[model samples]
Target: MQALGPWLPDDPALPPVALAVSGGGDSLCLAWLARHWRKNLLAFVVDHGLRAESAQEARLTVQRLADMGVPARLLTLTTLTKGPGVAERARQARYAVLAQACREAGCLDLLLGHQADDQAETLQMRHQAGSGPEGLAGMAWMSALPDVRVVRPLLDVSRQALRNTLRGAGLAWVDDPSNQDMQAGRVRVRHSLREQDEREALWRAGLQAGAARMRRDDSRTMSFARQGTFRPEGWVCLGPVLPEPEDLSVLIRCVGGQIYPPAPAAVRRLQAAGQEATLAGVQLVRWRSGWVLVREAAAMDAYGPAYAGARWDGRFELFLPSSVSRESLQVGPAGFGLDRTVRGGWPARFCATLPALWRHGQRVGIPHLGWWAEEALQGAGFLFQPPVPATGGGVYGWPEARGAWFAAHHI
Candidate 1:
């Protein structure tokens, strides 16, 4: 294995890492290498619980690490599908759990098992889809992934090297049956990525075009920040930020993609709703002062349930709605700060006194399920109500990056 540097690109210190191990050869190999490099590393194994022996595999993976004198934290979750789109839902859940673990552990860099082959496969798949430049860009080396920074150091490394490393270290991993299932889109893509040279050419062209577009997008995003004209919900009460008359849809897409850019019609409707009420979900809301991207039921905020009809006093349980949103409640005493964490436009001090309020959970909401309402709110440090100024936007109280332009805000 190549020696890891004292730092990841542009980062300082031998920062503690959180490795996302899946008990596969790829991830297990990564865990092995990472632990060898940094004593400060923390291993995080997530069991999707899709297979029968999934939890057992997780235990085994953890045990292997322990034998290496590396202890791991296991996070296992059942894949649930109430409706269609199980795959996407499962991915969202996985990342949500990983991000939470990273946060709790105070680890900054979250490492993944993606290697060059994964990138090639991704590029191949997207190219066939005739994807735009952005889509063809494939996996980024280091980027933000909800509550965490994701680093794919192996993007430059071949999969064979990872496999070889695992074997050399006497590690055995599982071969997921799903990978061989031709019915899977990715498997088909993998097969074709190996066969069609012409397709690979097109994909490479797409990647080049994508890189250019990313540069443009970065520029445009800077412009958007400077323009300071996107709003969805911070404490909401904003009008929609969509364009008028419906045809100029191009103006709605965000360069940063923090929220779903509303269609002109949707934007206008949300604008109307803000006056009389509020709209849920991530949408471009037009604030009277400006615009902000309002987050609704943000996938990153998928924690426990929301606290509805809950109490305070450090010993309470807030129940979540069966159909959940990103919004949550913080239970606490008076005089706590009122920020984005709580529900009402009110602060913690004011909202704490409310016999009937929680805090804002995240940037968005759907009200997941509030099944066991009675047993939950037995105690309360304080329900974190969603943050206020609901007319979404970070309260940096400064101009956008372009506007500020110190070069320190962003690289």
Candidate 2:
């Protein structure tokens, strides 16, 4: 674990840390180290309920951690409706449960044990899938989850070393039956990588290349952010020299207010779509001397107003005073034909796409537009945030401007 010193954040004021432990060799080693590193470590186990042994294994795992003096909790997930992508679905559910638990416990850091072998296996899998550099780069040492930061400290360490450590410490770990299922792509890839030593070099080179690429992109993205015009109306205008696909992905997520960027193929098409196109629910058009990104009017989300704090269109977070009742207000787009005189200089088309508060068949107000009708609501606040944090920096770079877009529009 001493090898982790260079990668750990220097801030000593970090909140209690959370680790996702599965009672497996990798995670168990992480749990042990985390217990010794931080007095306030919270261990979370997600029981996917996919197999008969899952429940008992979860209990035994937590019991062992508790015996080791680690605070632990088991989060049992309801069985998912049988799906084609059971593995992927289970993975998503697992992360969601862990992230929620971290939030509840006021932990910002979520640790995982993904060793060097896992990194090499990932690179192999992505390469076989015809992935780009971003995908082939494998996992980052640190990645931002919805609410928690995922720290993978074992990326440079070998899985065999971790297992040896556990065995030497007399720690027993549950061997998941699913890992041996050859039907899974990861299992197949893992077996192939085990026979090839060349992949280790590829893994190291891929990570280095990916990181160097990120550094170059970070500079480009920062310059774009400084020079571009990101309007409160959910539009961003940038120069004609388009950014790389990775940076374009970030821009699409931010401008479209989407939790995930569109697929790589879709991003490439959007980039080559000349002066106008729509992808990932975002419309891109040539405006003046540069490209502009805006939320596609027909694709935006709409929700009925809630009592106090309400999110509308997945773009605006609304906080109405207690005097306001949600039943009386309709929350949706202003749509075409909205009068713009009171909206100041906001573009008519853009203003029409804003989240409008409607009452008694009239538009009362919109976020960033100021309250128009006194009876509609007084002392109301609005915030513009996408479903996920916009990693304003490009691929593999620090999130230097992670929340800048939200901050600018949070009123």
Which tens-of-lDDT digit does each residue in 1-411 have in candidate 1?
Answer: 222223543333544678888878788888888777756677888888777777888899898877776669999786564455656677778877897788777777788898756766877776666554444566655564334567766654556678877777888887777678787777887777654344435434534554555565555455445544432212222223432312112232221123223334454665555432223334343445644443332211323333443422211224445443324444322223334444344333223232232345322221211112333333322232331111222111111222321221111
Candidate 2 clash pair list: none
The top-ranked prediction according to lDDT is 2
lDDT of predicted model 2: 0.71
For each candidate, the alpha-carbon lDDT, in order, equals 0.51, 0.71
Question: Can you tell me which runs of candidate 2 are displaced by over 4 Å?
Answer: 1-14, 232-234, 239-241, 257-261, 297-337, 342-365, 372-411
TM-score of each: 0.59, 0.79
lDDT of 2 by residue, 1-411 (tens): 343333344234655678899999999988887776766677998888888899999999999999877779999999665568998888778877887788778788788987777877877777777776556666766765446677887666677778887887899999998899999999988777754356557556656655766665567557666767667666777777666676677678877876556788878876766658888888777766777787888888764755454666766767788777666677778777755666576566666677777877777766567746755475665666665544422233222223111111111
Q: Cα deviation of 37 in candidate 2 (Å)?
A: 1.4
Worst 10 residues of 2 by lDDT: 402-411
